[model samples]
Target: MDDMIAGGCQCGAIRYSLAGPLPPAYACHCGECKKQSASAFSMSIPLDYDQLQVEGTPISFTTTAFSGRAKHNFFCANCGTRLWHSGSIPPDSITLKVGSLDDSSGIAPQGHLWVSKKQAGIKLDQAIEQFDTQPDDVTEWRGNLGQNS
Candidate 1:
């Protein structure tokens, strides 16, 4: 794919490239995101499974999320750096962590999800759309972003 974007894990154990022009991103403030990222929130760009091309063997951990969906997190086996995650909530789509990008300047989060669960002292952008919980439809969420922003 032309204009492909590429990135790797901290230790360069896991590398991946995605086709150009990924979907808009969002920040998740849910507890799972916080714990998984070791931060106040996690940001990711949703991409079709077919758009991702990976070059390393990553270990995976599957856990039931608060939404009752099974979330699969993949990480570099050598350095334990998280690569990406997929969940039943988004079926057939993979959420690529913005943090893993070689150049994250191209990625911009357009909204925030699970804001109700956002931790104390964690600030959010009031300018972007905010959802108290995960929206049932990602398209609806994106639509709201377009309409509101």
Candidate 2:
């Protein structure tokens, strides 16, 4: 965590630098995430909004979350690489897409969300903290992942 983590869009239009200490990432199996990732699940690392410094303008679209709050998705205009997501409910944080990282070799999801929608072919560690849907208690959820985070 001493060195800075950097990444950018495929076309190199939108670049970002993420500061440490990095928070634990999570694998989301929600339908929206699957569509966004075009895969079985989407990986996200939540950090303070300012922790991720952006260098270029990114086009964004708004979508409503299950919480009924507006969630904004930002992507590169050139390569259509989805960068991150921000929600109105939590104005101070951003969910950085793990795929956008230049070197994600060291990152791994500490928890899973929307497990009910998880792909049939995917297998998860039984010991990992997971939920069929969003956990009701943020504290409990965080506590469960604290060891790994």
Give every collision pair in model 2.
none
Candidate 2 residue runs with Cα over 4 Å from true position: 89-91, 137-144
List, residue by residue over 27-118, the lDDT tens digit for candidate 1. 99988899889989999877666677889887888999776768888889888888778774333567788899898885657899899999
CA lDDT for candidate 1: 0.79
The clash number for model 1 is 0
CA lDDT of each prediction against the hidden true structure: 0.79, 0.83
Assess the local accuracy of residue 57 in candidate 1 as a C-alpha lDDT between 0 and 100.
81
